[model samples]
Target: MFFRALLLLLILLCSNCENQKGETSPILQGLLALDYLILSDPDRSSVYFSTTRSASVEIAYEDGAEPNTGNFAVAPTTSVWSVTESNLINAFADRGYTVNVTVPTDLSSMSEFPDQGRSTWTINQLLALVPKYKAEDSNFQSAKFFVVFVKGSLAENSGVIAVTVSGAFGIGAPTVFVFKEIINHFQDNLSPDKVRKAEQMTVTHELGHALGLVNTGIPLSSDHQDTAHGNHCTNTSCGMYWALGDDRVDSFSPGTNPLIFGSECITDIRDYTP
Candidate 1:
């Protein structure tokens, strides 16, 4: 609908501007506008309500930050990847898009800091991994989202369990870094289920940032953005809340009945155009 109508209008305008050719013509201008409309927000363009393009999710972990436990032999079972992958697949499937999630692989030698406690990856260090991944894996460079499970914290925000870097800042697709050690420390490593659930909540919350939630990149249907915390919903029960707690994870299990995004966030996602 709306897109089709816009396309038809552009085509009709092109016909009228046939006599005036070259870059100054209305046709070129209209086409350029269309291109910007589609490409301006790359993540949202591919992830939200996109019928033509499918989405790919790449998972990688540092050498010491492998996302697996001995409790489950099903590879990523009882791991962060298991929960996040299934959540993304189900979310995209609901919107009529196929999502391809790669298995967790090792990202070696990219650690700039010495140890886990003081290891903080700067933006430049994170950007450096982009080319290395693109060189090794063919599908990595083109993925809509890149998730790296690491053992340290973000250079900018050390207290956060995870952080999302926007592709709009020239990183290509949005990249998410889950601080495995921090999550483990925060959860006190009590049990596999508790740690995994905490990790799942963190990853899902960060992925919401990648998808342009809370009026960041994606347009909002209503005024639900939390003015206090940037790019987070005001609803405390929502997964996109500023800070996630054990209660959130305990209440909502992945793949069963996860009300991750509240009504406002869902409205923004479904009502978005280009």
Candidate 2:
């Protein structure tokens, strides 16, 4: 296996030696993509949910979804990354894993989703892009997770805030998608801070799914899984609650912590051995 990987690396370097710097050859891209297929596992959550080694979460935003301080002028405290990264670190720290989440500034050098020129996306479309983008990550093998923020909605008006796909999806890389279009629709008549927190809540919630919350992959410590909703906690206060909330968006209130796992969910994570 070691020699095989070394040969592939040599091929990548030699194949691109005369091409433009930072651009991978078609053959190299195909080789890197094979890594994704080989990494596919039946147990999607265990690799991320209970890994003893430190893990990395890489984030990318589409052209429209790029993070900007300008959004703060329209809605105070609208920093998407600050809130999201903080909540992720806090949650994973509780589970005894050191998680590092990053939003790369240099996305032009990486593989990107093709310009489909649509306002909404389907899982199939995004799944096809996984191996391509996943191949670009330098830390692809170290318990890594991929997240992409796009300015669109899920297909057929699914009305979901976000979605998570595990190895079961056959993509190998576990991925989380946050739809800025759906999140923006909820900002009407509400403070940006509230909307900001709600968006953060959604990101963490889907990531919870990636971590195998409620009995998806990590077994339950108690009977709190809302089986009706498929891997959500029954507790209303929990971020993992199914359907999240209505269009008005009132799940988060002042002085209430919306970025959290319910106690039951935490118990399951902490008790997980693998």
lDDT of each: 0.63, 0.62
Quote each prediction's TM-score.
0.68, 0.68
Q: What lDDT tens digits, residue by residue, belong to model 2 across residues 51-134?
A: 434455666666676432222333344444444555556556665446565533334532345445668788887666566566
Residue-level lDDT of model 1, residues 1-274, one tens digit each, is 3454676677677757774654456565667566565455444433345542445556666667865423222233344455565555545554544445543422332233223333888877776666665323212223456677777777787888888875433225667877888888774444666676677678778887877777766777888889889889998887788987767756765445544777777777777755
Global local distance difference test of model 2: 0.62
> Whose TM-score is greatest here?
1
Q: Give candidate 2's error at residue 178 in angstroms.
A: 1.6
Question: Against the hidden true structure, what lDDT does model 1 obtain?
Answer: 0.63
